[model samples]
Target: MDRSPPVIVFPPESGGGRRVTIRGEAVGTAHGLFDVLELLHSAGLPAVDTAVDDPELIEWRGGGPYDWNDGEADER
Candidate 1:
């Protein structure tokens, strides 16, 4: 059976915030997520947190599906 991939929508960082759109199926794995984060960080837009409805399906924010030891960032 085939399943439709989840959609990842990144909220804006500040003031009227811009929306960043990314495909879930294209980045539905740990590595893919990490790569996305790294890309964002490199672009000077590191995510403060991520949110998703389905935990088992995908981690929408804050390094989902991966162990993050850095607790310095606020996820509120």
Candidate 2:
């Protein structure tokens, strides 16, 4: 049986804040890598420092880590 990853980082919202979910439960919103790390830490997750970049540990949707932009560019 294939099991999903424990942590899920949703697509960036309108404000560049992504939704984080752990074990199928909504945890919080994160605007950057540090924020995601903090959320993982608060969730009592182990090895959060390294887990942030672990694809198997965290499922990044829409974009990978470091992608906090809301997909908008400034008009010249």
Candidate 3:
């Protein structure tokens, strides 16, 4: 699937101004990252690095949040 360009998902039963997620990972609530998002939006960019080696960006097709589930897990 095309995971690029990032996807921002809002919380359930909430309005646009709520918890946000990028690729299934929580970045911040809408009220939290408002300024950062605005800057990126104005620049025509899609996302921020979020962290120095984003854990969410690491591909995982496993069962749950456990990263070291097994040695055969597929990770990018």
C-alpha RMSD (angstroms) for model 2 = 4.1
TM-score of each: 0.25, 0.82, 0.30
- Judging by TM-score, tell me the better candidate of 2 and 3: 2
- For model 1, give the 10-residue run with minimal summed lDDT: 65-74
Name the runs in model 1 displaced over 4 angstroms.
1-31, 49-76
Residue range 1-76, candidate 2, lDDT tens digits: 9978899998889866899999999989988878888888887886456787887789988877867777433121
Each model's lDDT? 0.36, 0.80, 0.37
Query: What does each candidate score in C-alpha RMSD?
Result: 12.0, 4.1, 13.6
Whole-model lDDT, model 2 = 0.80
Q: Which RMSD does model 1 reach against the true structure? A: 12.0
lDDT per residue for candidate 3 within 1-76, as digits (tens), equals 7554343433322242344445465655433344335534554554464521244432222222222223222242
Most lDDT-accurate candidate: 2
List the candidate numbers ranked by lDDT, top first.
2, 3, 1
